[model samples]
Target chain A: MKHNFGAGPCILPKEVFQEASQAVIEFNNTGLSILEISHRSKEFEQVVIEAEALVRELLHVPENYSVLFLQGGASQQFAMVPMNLLPEGGKAAYLDTGVWASKAAKEASKLGNVEIVASSSDKNYTYIPQGFSVPSDAAYFHFTSNNTIYGTEIFEKPAVGIPTVVDMSSDILSRVINVADYDLIYAGAQKNMGPAGVTLVIVKNELFGKSGRTVPTIFDYQAHAKAGSMYNTPPVYSIYVSMLNLRWLKAKGGVEVIEQENIIKARTLYDEIDRNPFFKGTANVEDRSRMNITFVMDTPEQEAAFLNLAKERGLVGIKGHRSVGGFRASVYNALTISSINALVDTMREFEEKTK
Target chain B: MKHNFGAGPCILPKEVFQEASQAVIEFNNTGLSILEISHRSKEFEQVVIEAEALVRELLHVPENYSVLFLQGGASQQFAMVPMNLLPEGGKAAYLDTGVWASKAAKEASKLGNVEIVASSSDKNYTYIPQGFSVPSDAAYFHFTSNNTIYGTEIFEKPAVGIPTVVDMSSDILSRVINVADYDLIYAGAQKNMGPAGVTLVIVKNELFGKSGRTVPTIFDYQAHAKAGSMYNTPPVYSIYVSMLNLRWLKAKGGVEVIEQENIIKARTLYDEIDRNPFFKGTANVEDRSRMNITFVMDTPEQEAAFLNLAKERGLVGIKGHRSVGGFRASVYNALTISSINALVDTMREFEEKTK
Candidate 1:
């Protein structure tokens, strides 16, 4: 099997993928393909309920926080966040860390005033900016915990009392996080969860039923929370696969255990990059993401050669984003330590060959 | 497998569902589940291209139109339609046939002035309102082609110069449709195409880039048309299954052939309902949906018993929506003739036993 490190729509546990595949064909031995089963059916209702309940158990989510599997991904949440929370003349604070964070801020700008509390753009977004205070007057403070493109992660959550919103797409399940730290948390379920369609939104109920604008029915979080995320036919297959992955997480001893393993996998590859002469790490060492490890070869020709070499070693999706071209090894929760070892071994062999 | 007539997240062809399930396990033998594959990968790009191509080929979509596989289903489109097409201070004409149509109009009312040009709510939405004129001054004339809840359908296009928008969520692809008759058409993929997450939107490019509102990036048609539906990581599994289902539709001799089968299936059920003293169809004969066939038993107790009998016969999802509860057998494009026959036979057996 190839070592998959492609960034979000990244790795999922093989067992989870297999179970999901089985469920697709015959869910709970209902003799109905998961795809064909009605979302309103009792069986699927259990799937939704269990998925939500698991999220609460895993995250230790406080009471009154709602867990929703919504469609349109996190991209939709960019607009929805502002549409629902930011009133007609409201202002919100945003941390501009990377492409996605900037995109989220931009979406909010179209709806209302968006104040950039901090940004790392001047430094090519290699590290998360720190020491910038969010205004209490702002409607909410939004930040992305991990940057997939730039390979930076905020190791420390902003210690503030303001309502915080974090887009934890890439690093959601790979680590243990305090659910009570943020008022709202939205993550695209592609990485560290299940697939690309459904977005997981964990929002506090205190914020619900209080939007100032005439929020579109689908964009309104209060409406979704009230209806239990079934205001319409939800993305069934995506949500079910997510449920299977969550089950896998629980079986693997939950987030704390997985987080330690993820740290180990990342350290192995980063240690190799630091020791090897032919390669250089990209992101600042302190803020480098454990999930997405970015590095570069000595030259473009060397980088090109190493990519093919990695591919030959059954390492796929090691090629990095074009904006920061080199390599990105996304070691998500599902990527095994052996896969990271394989990638590290390939890197060392490539260096020897070049020398 | 059971006869899946559940109103969407509905039935898909067995072959298509099987193929989709297989793909979920290992897509293209990449050892990566289609669920876990990166949307940026060439393999997935091809899936998206081929799916869009299949849509164009099967529907004879015009060169000037853009086909999008979007998330958020049709409920989001209720707001998106007006957000993309309805100008500021503009008014649009809406035909309030049933639940979905009214929901669409209600969403539009939040954005701009909505004229309820015609409504069948006066008759409990059991028939499509006819002989109503569309206002030329309106920005668009919007309607739902089929109402899954009430078993009503609009058979004829509005004879108006205004742009036409149809939410074909329940009946799309079961019959042939003229591409030029409507400027834009959107359908949730669940019923006639694939599943509940991905929505199919075919919009004329000419009508785009003309909207007066600053549509949220996710809601803007022009933005999606420009990106070719890759603005976000799409509902990958849903779109891929839709492609597989669309391919099946083409192999089955396209919509024309399927429409004929649908007609026959509906006829058999309607014939049985009309001939027997036990049941009666709810919709007016001329406007009753061929897609969703709604019927009621002579008494509430008999209705309960018939549902039990239908379930006992390995038949399912024949329960009517609560709004007009009795039975709603939604025979979409993927529902087979044999399944219809099974439903008919069960009805006859129940009727004879009760008598």
Candidate 2:
């Protein structure tokens, strides 16, 4: 058994994997591999419907919102959000929390005027910026809710008077959020949802066509909503596997139940970091992420030694982003408390060895 | 034994499915689900490299062309082709063979001026238009190589003298093609390549960054090519499975061997359609697609009865598109000669029952 702490394209339930794997061979006893079935077929149409419904239920998304399963990841959404929301010559306010946040602002700037309301870039994005006001005249306020690389997250949706859009790619479905608070929420479903193909977009229906730009039909949210996320052939197997994982999430008592487990998991690992002498947490204490827990050692040699030990014990994907050297154990919703214990045990083992 | 005749998201080799399903559970003995591994990992980096290499080997793609595994299907490419190739105020010429072809032109029209050099819509797109002159001044000439819905195909690349782009969504790897002739060739992997979610783009390196328009980074071909399709986390499992399918294709003696099989399979089915008194082929004989074979009965009742008979014989997804209002048997590369014989035998059984 391995404890996978990879950030994005990360772990899902073993049950989900078993079922998903089975479907690749024979889907629903339909005498067809899920990979080969037509996206237009009733069976696949139901997969999309159920996946959408699960998102709505898990997040408590309002009826006015459209849940879309799209492609191209959050990188595509960076451009699409601006294209669909920022009108010609309109300005959009952005809070740059990390690389992803900065990229979002940069992409938006290409379409129209963009104002960086706040940025944590000065300190290598170690914390989410605070006490910054979003420009009221801006068409929309955009921010990254979770910074996977920097090990920081903005838990509270900023009370900006303008429409709010958040990139929840790393932390979506791991915790609860009020869907009504944001005009749009987009996430690449690799982190907590399922895998690395489909993107989840939950946008308020009223926000449609507000940009007044000739958005490509494929990029337009309204076109996807009107067509029920079947504007064209969607990532069929990805969406289908996502549906299976969503079903798994729903069975595990939905997001509320998972949120409490996530809190415990983060706290357990963070407690070990605080208690251990050889290791140190990187993010500011107040803004430390509950998903990706970044940490480092006093020396590169020590860090490498710990990583080797972690590997010997079946701990994989704990290496940190190059921008923030050391280790990042991404403990998403699917990661169990036992895995947290295993990591804590390893950290203690490292301390004992060092002593 | 089910013979899937779905137009797209169609069949792949049984061996590919077996290997793909196993990888999902435990990818390459890594003790991690394929769905969970980090895209930045060396393991997955190898998957992308091998997939690209296999494509180059199978298609005999020149070193000057970059093979990209992208998302959002060919629909996204319809816009990206224009965004990347058609300069601001420049004109692109298009050949309208069916819905997909027209849609491609329509998307391009939004980005720059598009000229419909020719269209076969006069005969309900039953035939491919010939003797059309493409404007020499156009930035690019775009056409759909295979019309899945209309059951028509253009096997030859028309000499247009401009940057030629073809959407070979349905017939890409079923036969050999000169990659040097076309400036850009894209195909949704569902038909002849792999499954849905991932799209294959073989673009000449010289065509990059010539649009003179500020294309979104995600939509820009140069960005994708430079990053080696790792511009963002690609559809991981989709690409992995495609690699498996491509490996299967290579092991089965590459495109040359499969082309012969496809030819024999198509001829066997088309022969049955021609000989059967109760059925008639829909598309023009000269332009009939080797991949998607469309045909119809004289009456709706007869068509319905034949469809029922086909389903009973474990032949699925043979029902044609509503636009064509007939039966469309999509015999992709993975579809065996036995499947063709089964479809033909079913057609003969229908004729005998009717008599």
Candidate 3:
């Protein structure tokens, strides 16, 4: 059997994709394609409303927080968060974890002043910097929860005194968190939640109304809040599929249960890498991600051989990002424990063959 | 048979959605879910490259033009077009045809001097304004090609001496046009295309490097152009479904054949409205849109009864925008001729019963 470890647009529950395929043809027996349904209609509105509520309930978001199914993914939010939340000429603090954080910092700098509080890029982001100081007077502090490429994650969310924005694009819903602690949290749906079109944004209502900027209605959190994420034609199919995935997650038990399974999956593969001398892991062990596990062979030649042999054995998408040349096995929420075991077995087989 | 007349997030061809649904699961038997496939993979990259080529081929885009897939819909472009293309303190001539045009004007006004060349709002946008003049030294002349709410369209695109930017969100790909005439053309995918979450932007390459403003990377057409629309994690499912729709359109004899069918669909409904004294067609005949046809009754009683009766008979989503205070039948490209024929039959039955 083949195991897909593609770091995202990554694995999704088979049942969710199946139900989504069916919905595309006949949405709740409406005899109309989901694509054709009006966003404001009773049926479609239920999707946005229920999806929002589920996100809030699952994450334990406070009543003051508004959940939005926005378009443009987390990359867009990198700019929009600063644009709508930052007061004109305001300064924001950012932690440079990896590529995503760097991109966020660049976009935020365009709208207002952004100071990089700390960066692990000096060591090629092989680890997440700890104990960074956020500016007291900044608009907000920003950080990426997980570095997908570098295979590092801040297991514990940093404590920022001021309002905070976290890009949880790669690791959201994989585990439970204190939703009330965050002022704004956005996740691109492609990785752990759903497909690629929708970005889930949850924001504290009170933190807004301070920006004093005329944000384009599409970019404005208040506009999305009032409309319940249906201000314009939303990513209907994507959101519907997200609803299905969330439902699946709830059925398998919510984030808390899934977090246990995720821990088991990550540990199984990491143990194999640690005990086996044939493969060397990339990121610092303490800062390693439970989702994306990056590793390499003892030599470049062995790495190439291992990749080819693994592909021949139906293990696909194990190649790491070019910036960090190695192999990465992304075991997201939908990644079964069996898939991780298969990778570990594949690695063991490679080791025996090389020996 | 059920007929959907949603203004947009509207109907697509039955086969398009079916094929798209299949791809979500298998996607060329890659054994990985489409969601699991890497965007950098040759398989998915080919999908985007081919989609762009198909768009260019269908539009007969000039060699100087490049097709790009973007996020946040046309609403985002309302600001981005000016932000990336409009030089600092430069004046842009805008013809406000309807709601969308006014939105574009509002966004452009934020960046630079906006000269309102003409406005059809004097007639509540029920008729298109004629004999408009563009500023001789304007940056570009911007207008909405089809007003979804107002049911007015520029049947013949106006010639502006300066560069022209047209929001063809509603009627795009339904009719043929000289793509080279406009410097930029953008269309949201939900209407007459495939789905939400993807916006098609076809722009003249020469138009860039003229704007002095340091636009955010996501908002810059050049940034997307350089990355071939993979500058960020694109709305993958949306784009893949769009490719399916485009392929289906091509298989069904391309735009020319579909355009004729759209004309027949519009003429059928418009003819019924003109013959029935109970109905009053809203837009002027010369400016009436072939896509969105708006009409109303003399009394609120008639309007309420008509809507309820139609709903009972499996006619869904025909209600117009509340701002317009009437009914609208949006005959996008995928809307079958038989659907319009059924609506006309329904209209006739209603008129006879009332009389």
Candidate 4:
């Protein structure tokens, strides 16, 4: 048996694959493949509408927030968020957690005065910086909910009275959050949501058209919101698959129930690492990401051995990011507790062999 | 039996769908779903690299021209092309054919000085406007290769002495063309390529960085081109489907073979539309798009009856744009000759009933 723990574009529910595969052949009894359907037609419009509604329902988003299904990953939102909200000299505070946070900060810097209020980069982002304060005059406070590369997460989101924007690309739908707390939240549908082509953007409608700079229509939140996310042809198949995944999430007790299962999976593996002397977990204990668990061996030789052995035993995508080399097991929402148990068993076996 | 005629997010080949379905279940004998693989891992990277290389090979693109797999569809490129290539305070010329052309023109107007050098809007864009002169000092002359909504195409791409950018969203890969003819060519993957979520951008490296405006990194063509389209988590699943489709295209006598099939399909339908007194062809003969065939009846009652009959007979998406008030049969690359024949038969039957 194989377990998939790749970070983004990671594991999805089996039912989603089965249903999406059938849809690819024939969609909605229309005798047309989902790939061939028109986005404007009533059949596909239902898809767009329901997908948006499900997003709102799943996240418990308020009526004031507009959920947009867009293209480009979270990287696009880094630029879009600032382009639509920041005036020429307006400042937006950013909390730099890791690679994605820095990329977002870089994009915003070109649009306006991007103030890096707090950054975990000083310590290579091994922990989420805490006690950061947002500027009262700032347009918005942007933060990455989960850092994939560094295996860190903001255990407690900062309270910024102004509009709060988050790049939840890696952790969306993995846990529940107060949708009302955030003015805008965007996530690339790769990790826990659905697929790679779609990005979900939930924004407070009242926060738009404030940017003095002429924003591109495609990048403007208002343009997408006004068109109901159909300003242009959206990522149809990806969005559909996301809808299926969201349906699965709903059926599987929604975010509230899934969060407990996720914690169990993450805790089991982390506990094994803590007890085993040969292996060490990365990230500050409180800031460690429940979704992606990164670990390293005491020696480089052991680390290489473990990775090769893991792959041979049908355990995959455990190699950590090159920037922070080690091993990473992404325990996303789809990752079953059995998979985590198997990994714990592998770790125990390797330790026994080494001893 | 259903015939899909939507301009984009349109039809795809059966074999491509079959292969994609299988891959979703088990990719490359890994026993893991394609969604489970890591993009950074060698396995997934091979897929991305090979897909880009295949596009370059199929188009015969020059070494200097970089191919970028981006998100946000070609509409994003409408703004990005100008934001990345238009010099500060610089002017650009555009040929407005239909809705998409006007949309791009509108976006460009917001960025810099836009010259509507030519427009078929005078004639409700029933035909492509020819004999337009582009300014030598202008950054570039932008035009839509095929107007999906209006059913017109500029078959012989205008040789504007300045840099030329074309939105090939509707007819890309339908025929072979000199990749060097334009400075930039972008197509949304849903039409003739694969599915929605991925946009293919082929651009000359030298023409970039001319726009003195600070382009948001996501909008910067250079950033994507330099990174070999891996600047961010790309539209992985969409691009993967595109690779499968392109591979199928290459196997079926490449673009040259598909072009012949496309020409035949368009000719058969247009002949029926022109010969029948009950219907009238919408586009001028010289500018008729081989990809999208538009027509209308003498009366709205007859038009509604024809559409209703067509839907009852398993014919779909043949209704025209509301702005145009007619019927449009989008004969994209994946549209079979049998489907067009079916549409022609439907038209003949409708003509017989009305006459």
The lDDT of each candidate is 0.89, 0.93, 0.88, 0.87
User: lDDT per residue, candidate 2, A70-186, as tens digits?
Assistant: 999999999999999999999999999988898999998889999999998889999888899988899999999999999998999989999999999999999999999999999
Docking class of 3: medium
Q: Cα lDDT for residue B101, model 2? A: 96
Error of 1 at A188 (Å): 0.3
Candidate 4 residue lDDT tens string, A1-355: 7888888788898888888878878888988778778888798899888888888888899999899998878888888888888888899999999988999999999888989999888788899887778899999999999999888987566978888899998888888899888888999899988978788999998988878667878888998999999998888888898988999999998999999998889999999999998889888999989988999887889998888788877787888998888998999999899889888988998999989
True contacts kept of 2: 0.88
lDDT of 3 by residue, B19-75 (tens): 877877788878876766888789999999889988887878898988999988899
Query: DockQ scores for all the models shown?
Result: 0.81, 0.90, 0.72, 0.76
Shift in Å, residue B345, candidate 4: 2.2
User: Model 4 off-target regions past 4 Å?
Assistant: none
In model 1 chain B, the worst 10-residue window by lDDT is: B207-216
Query: To one decimal, what is the Cα RMSD in angstroms of model 1 from the true structure?
Result: 1.2
lDDT (Cα, 0-100) at A210 in candidate 1: 51
- What value does the lDDT take at residue A78 in candidate 4? 88
Candidate scoring better on TM-score of 2 and 3:
2
lDDT tens digits, residue span B181-237, model 4: 999999989888898888999999997788878877777888888887888888777
Cα lDDT of model 1 by residue, B1-355, tens digit: 5888888888888888788878878899787889878898899999999999999988899999999998888998999998988889999999999878999999999999999999999889998887889888899999999988999887678687889999998888888898889999999999989977899999998988566788888888888888879999999989899999999999999988998999899898889989988889999999989999999987888988888988889888999999998999998888888999999899889877877
Q: Would you list the rank order by lDDT, best first?
A: 2, 1, 3, 4
